[model samples]
Target: MTIAPRDLLRRMFDAAIAAAQPARCVPACLPEPPKGRLVVIGAGKASGAMARAVEDHWPGALSGLVVTRYGYKVPCERIEIMEAAHPVPDAAGLIAAKRIQKLVSDLTADDLVLCLISGGGSALLALPLDGVTLEDKQAVNRALLRSGATISEMNCVRRHLSAVKGGRLAAACAPAKVVTLLLSDVPGDNPMDIASGPTAADPTTCADALAILQRYAITVPRTVLEVLESGRGESVKPGDPRLAGCQTRMIATPQMALDAAAAVARAAGYPVHILSDRIEGEARDVGSVLAGIALQVAGRGQPFTAPCVLLSGGETTVTVRGSGRGGRNVEFLLSLGIALNGQPGIHAIAGDTDGVDGLEEIAGAHLGPDSLSRAWELGVKPKDRLADNDGHGFFETLGDSVVTGPTLTNVNDFRAILIER
Candidate 1:
């Protein structure tokens, strides 16, 4: 075989990235040329790249605004791309989100509101719900990050407490037909989970959002809690008439990317197995579970024959008991490597599809037999690093960090486990 293990891994990663290319994913999903004005608005790490693709493909005159993470900006004409805080919202996000809402306020029924949404959108598109202060929202968001809630559940809370989430944005375009092209970073590709369903209906209720908050013990200002309890700022429901004309399409997803990677693996004569596209929960715990499965396959070959790859994708959370500087992917890899205990003939990779793991530039990390021994030789303790909540620093020092810059799209987490015969 011409493919080395690492080479095959690189090839698969490349395929995954190719599957999520904004230029291709965005253009292919473009709706037919609408007769009316085409106003482009979006938010996410990939929003800038998606906007540029829209500008290049759509023959209609397009103009609008979008917000993206600070370093994930791309060039676009007519549509303004604003940079903002990610994984957390700031004044920049607040301002840009407001601009987007204002831009659609007066749209006529004939106009087309093309919303380009992707991962990181929830933070980049932050516009607190009426009666809730931005500070209040920020505090709640920080709490959620530490609460170990899944992205969908966290978004459930955000959707009900936001001015633009849960179907409100689509409602804002009222009468104007809205078509959302989404590059899903959320698992399950549930339109409702993509950036909190800015252009889709929200099946969750204020009561649901409140339940999530209570489940995590995320305390909020008394006024904010009252608003949720009172349902004063509840999101638009699934059957709301305003969303009747709204249409959404998943232009990209974790499964699509994983399928692309699997294709590469198959071409190389390696057997492949995909567990799921929507696995959830704490990063380390999920890693342990995957490690257990890998061990079963490697030892007894019950799950698959030797020389096979196990793949899975989904978003995971970190409870943040430590002060680590890593995201869930890195944490997962760390815990997974430790669980495997440097076992021979097994290696793995875990990362976020957006080229970022956690809040760092590292896409994720790789594991091999020597990984654990090497850490020990260098005076690095896996448990210590994991406890500090700093997977990035640990992996960075070991030179095992997978940094791919910004792939400009997010389909959430990607994991690959390889076993040699």
Candidate 2:
């Protein structure tokens, strides 16, 4: 059966999303009823869906609060789902963070704190340290995001500045078994990095957060600096007594998403090639390199012949040099288009698997051989847009941004394409 390249590309992306759907991942990882009370807590874009998953799978009296990004809520039987600001946290997040902190503090040794953590939780569950207000945290967070810092580095600073993160949430539930069900969105999938590791032991220290701040050249108030320098609110260490019963289990990840896309490609009469699930570096550079590989396959039939899909999953970083809207996925596509120079019959799509890329509402963008031509007719100039880091804007004008709202689950970035005659 012959398949259109665009159709095959969509199939690959859809399969990736289906594989990482929260409904399938969140249910089976839930813990049974505890000996005493069961306290459910979580924060992320997926927290709402995770809460709903737990309610459907676990049959017991459960009560707790979870914070998710606005417009990412799912109906839950008992767990309270609170909508908060994401990418940049807001006042709603501040209140929810305090509430969850108080909830964990009330836990007894016999109780079980089932903590559901995923990507975007760091900004969603915002409880700033004493003397450091939410505004302070917000300022720092906003700067770090565009500083080209890796996820690990950005999270390192976040863990130190929060009252609920860096193991403090687990510390509050001392004596109670804190079991964290994590759906990793960050490469390396470090528990300490996901949502800043709210219920896991933190290996990063206050000094480390300060060092990151220095590396990024982020300027904060003296009070915020003092709090970090004093080390008064350091997170639970690896062997802290309060974390003796804390545990973390990864339920979903980027590899799983890549595998799913690969399956679709193979079944669609195309040779599947997975580049890397942990890919990272500058977004535009990654795009240029991928374009080279596509050219090789399309022109010389090297790597893989026609009717092959190249797949990759990983977080890509973008250094903000322009005052325009930017997302890693869109940036990649814009760069890819420039490199390809409208090379015929090489179609592609690049997007965040979670259905939101960077700060935009679009999940990602889809491209065809005529994408540049369509974009040109739409008055889109590839070089000018890329120079401004306005890839989202470029795609938006061309009517190519793939907006799926919130998929409510994040495995990281997904990139796939079909090269054909």
Candidate 3:
């Protein structure tokens, strides 16, 4: 029953992703058929899949629309699956956002609005507030992506700028009981943070968003600043009557995914330790810290000992300064590989559960004792690539990049370090 380190790591990663798939997690969370119409509306990388899951499980007729990243769409017979730009939203997303907002409006209390929310909804559900154009939001989104701001910070700013986010969408569905099913990809799994909480009441205010923008040095258009400063951009706060009928259910989460991965590792005869499912901070710094732990377990056996796998799940930020392909997971793996220094019997894999990291189609990469040696042999300077934030390029050249296409699920980043004695 001995398993190769690389295959074992991949299995654990796959298990983590499969555990969070909408088809498996969404049905139980689905609310009973509404007295009136059942309208499904959502936006995220996994929204398309979530819609399909709802279509398959519901007994009565349901119709709706959902927006997903360009390549993340899943076919649905009843619900319309729309494709849009992500990370930096485009005109398509703006149009879709307006349409989604309209769809949820004008509903009665007897009607049910089933909102499917997951990661990436903030950008996919882009509908800039009045006085702020889509281009303005795009510029701010691009800057925020490169600013090394945590997801929460970026989302806080987004909530203030968007017309649909920060519980505005839920407010639009006023009088209709809004039931939201979420697949959490953020660090804390806060419903308000997922997809900027389009269907959940936001406790954050315009002041909080403005402070995040100032802290990150992210420049917004004058109109955006005016909205925030004038308090016009404030979100629907808690206890708002518009959101009184709203309810949220976390269908899948990072901790659940991590626990599933741990089960696979344990059944394969390796003890597993999940450090944290909410770890955050800079990608490289997290990698370095994990490397230190792996080294300790591999050498001194002080913590969990060797012949075990360490698992963790959480999103990490990368301050993109280099003009190279960058994904937080790949950056993490590259940094982890370098810090390991080709230590024997230490292997790791890091990938985004949704199968895309940053802007790259690649999920993430793998690291072994010879990852550095292989890069050096291929004339690739690991340190230089790391500095340039070119982890995708570094691993792609070595044919070690993990590509899973669109996994149709996101529980954030998954990292596994295997220490074999």
Q: Which of the numbered candidates is closest to the native, going by highest lDDT? A: 3
After best superposition, candidate 2 residue 346: deviation in angstroms? 1.3
Structural similarity to truth (TM-score) of each candidate: 0.97, 0.96, 0.99
Candidate 2 per-residue lDDT, tens place, 291-349, comes to 99999999999888886888888899999899888899999989998999889888899
TM-score of 2: 0.96
Tell me which of candidates 1 and 3 scores higher on lDDT.
3
Cα error of candidate 2 at position 342, Å = 1.5
Note the Cα lDDT for every prediction shown: 0.87, 0.87, 0.92
Clashes of each: 5, 0, 0
Q: Between which residue pairs do clashes occur in model 3? A: none
Q: Residue 198 deviation, candidate 2, in Å?
A: 0.5
Error of 3 at 50 (Å): 0.8
Model 2 accuracy (lDDT, Cα) = 0.87
